[model samples]
Target: MKEILERRYTLTPFKKEIKGLKDAFRRASLRNLDSMRKRGFRPKNISYYEEVILGEKRYEELKGFSGRIIGYFCTFIPQELIYAARAIPIRLCSGFYDTVLVCEEILAKDICPLVKSSFGFKISASSYFELCDAVILPTPCDPKKKLIEILSDYLPVWVLKIPQDKTSSSKEIWLEEIKSLKERIEDFTKTKLTRQRLEETIKLIHKRQTLFRQLYEIRRANPYLMGGRDFLLVIQTSFYDDIERWIDKTEELCKQLSKEKTHFKTDEKIKILVTGSPIIWPNFKLLNIIEDLGAEIVCDDLCSGTQSLYNLVEPDEPTTDVMLGAIADGYLLSSVCPCFIENNDRIDRVLNLIEEFRVGGVIYHSLRLCQLYEIESHRLRLILKEKKIPMLTIHTDYSQEDTEQIKTRVEAFLEMLKR
Candidate 1:
């Protein structure tokens, strides 16, 4: 019993060897800075990403503070509730290549790389990982579901259930689940979820979402002003750091974009909408190759991209029940994940983004072993065919060895699109 409990929270001998991996992750991200600069991306505007990507800055700041810090995997987990309980909720998703290599040895080499990277980071004792008082994991897909089962063996894990479909009946069930999660959060933090506090948190997060929406709109309206790489980094950074600062920086970025009449010759570049598994920062190989091959990703429906921030939490009534219900429904209805099969939410999102951005082509990127997204790409292909929009689907893993192959395919697709 003592051995099992000890193993649940600490590391094994191999994981201990990589305890201080902050520099490794930073070096990996900085590998592309020169290329980004050559492409005219603003380095100053993205300084926050470099500062907090490894969690050293925030961890240092909060080291003396006595408060619970919850790490969660999916966006489906309601962050407002965590904030309401006076606890911080940080996203624990991963994109580090070294960490994924470490995880593959223990968690099977064939699973999703994102899941492996996340678990590997946790086991490696990242400062951000160390600050996690608990982990809230939700099962929107199979890899994540199994990942949490393995993660619970090493860390304190709380599983939050979500509905697989967007039926009225399922939405009601999701509401109950949200309420249950609130209770779990409250139990963890020993703080009560008061009506006033819940309302305040909801408005606070909704305000941030509104600014994020503005940034999303400006990307399509002014593609030359911001590239997909910077936009994705900003969004990914917001997942794990200070929410207010993210809002301010995003607002500042949009303000600068709206004022500047940045223009680029669009005759050669095909406007494309990318949809697939979450592409976190530093893993921007696909976007880089697409743009390099003469395509402008004006907007994307990917989980890590713009689609997650589309819905606002608006309560029909000024009550805790109504507010919680609104928050739960917003995620259920606006979610772009293909995990929701009984409805056409994913199709609706893709078609809407394509029309809204005037996207000429769709690049459906399904990461290897991510069965749900891969399965849904076929349906999206049929839907795009009916609409007479061109598309290319690519199944890829998180390795740069396939970069040349992906770039070749993207180049060929761009040629067809231009014709």
Candidate 2:
């Protein structure tokens, strides 16, 4: 029944239209690229404003404005906090004015370079700290903790402690932390965040998230109606501070997908799910590499992928309460990345996706020296092996520069899966 569903999805005429829609997006991206450059922009990484028009200037330019600026150390911080504070909350992932130089001073050099690079970017410029009113660090991992320690020394850093244990008590800890986070935000911003504001933010976010999830569903509808590569661009374009534009893109993409139908070629027998921690940025090359090797990347469970697909917000609930609930839940909990946690349910979720998708294999991407994900890689391989699922694990920084070796391993893995 599942295979039949997959087959029908891939071959339908709708899939063809969907594929066309994906191609149209690429052309659109290119067409806009020159204009984007004129607007002082780049690709999905930095030109998000150009991509969606979130006001012409960079988000940090409002220096004279008395609005507080909240910085989240990762992607998981509740956006409602920023909305509630009447402040701009930016994820501390990238696009800083300076090179990172604080990692070595605060953290062990043995950790990943990404963390180091982020620190370098921040410390490279003095103005980096000037725009930040406070830092929200979710206790998701050691690197994040170290990042908080370093940033706190320079600015107001509030740490939201996440529970290491995967139990009912975890929810309790999260609720208390949410309250604490609320108080902290109010204290620092001198803005009274009422329940109504929080609730409003929740409704807005929920609407946005629902559209985001639907876009993924369209992307996931297979024969490859939508190019996963293009789909990733849609996802990464939302990471920055453009809430309105993000929502617009989501709606537009959904409308486009709904009107079209298409699927990717099924010439390659091998199909797999790419698994890893949160992909800090979108990398379309990973999808390209697999397809180039006569293999199909049917799905991914990365943070920037399926793991981001979340449930809907209740319409009857108060917006702030829903916002509070979202925080208490792990939806926006940046620190609870499955790679950094010891939860078996996450592992099980991966396996289930693999099974339901009828994936022939699993490709585990572990960032170099990303200790938690590396550990999970080994355990996952064992579990997959027991299930007779061929697996390949690769370690590298998330750079397109490493494509050659990654391609080789991916090709070899697909060959093994084929056999």
Please estimate how well model 2 matches the true structure, expressed as its whole-model Cα lDDT: 0.59
**Which candidate tops TM-score?**
1
Put down candidate 1 lDDT per residue, 168-286, tens digits, no spaces. 89888889878888888887788999999998889899998888888776766767666666777777777777788878877777777777644543533578888888887667778
- Against the true structure, whose lDDT is highest? 1
Model 1, total clashes: 0
* Candidate 2, backbone clash total: 29
C-alpha local distance difference test of each model? 0.78, 0.59
CA RMSD for every model?
A: 3.5, 13.3
Worst 10 residues of 1 by lDDT: 1-10
Query: Deviation in angstroms for 177 in model 2?
Result: 0.7
| Inter-residue clash pairs, candidate 1 | none
TM-scores, each model vs. reference? 0.92, 0.76
Please list the residue runs of candidate 2 whose C-alpha ends up more than 4 Å from where it truly belongs after superposition. 1-66, 94-108, 126-131, 262-270, 282-288, 291-296, 309-316, 319-323, 330-336, 339-341, 398-402
Q: How does residue 258 of candidate 2 score in lDDT? A: 63
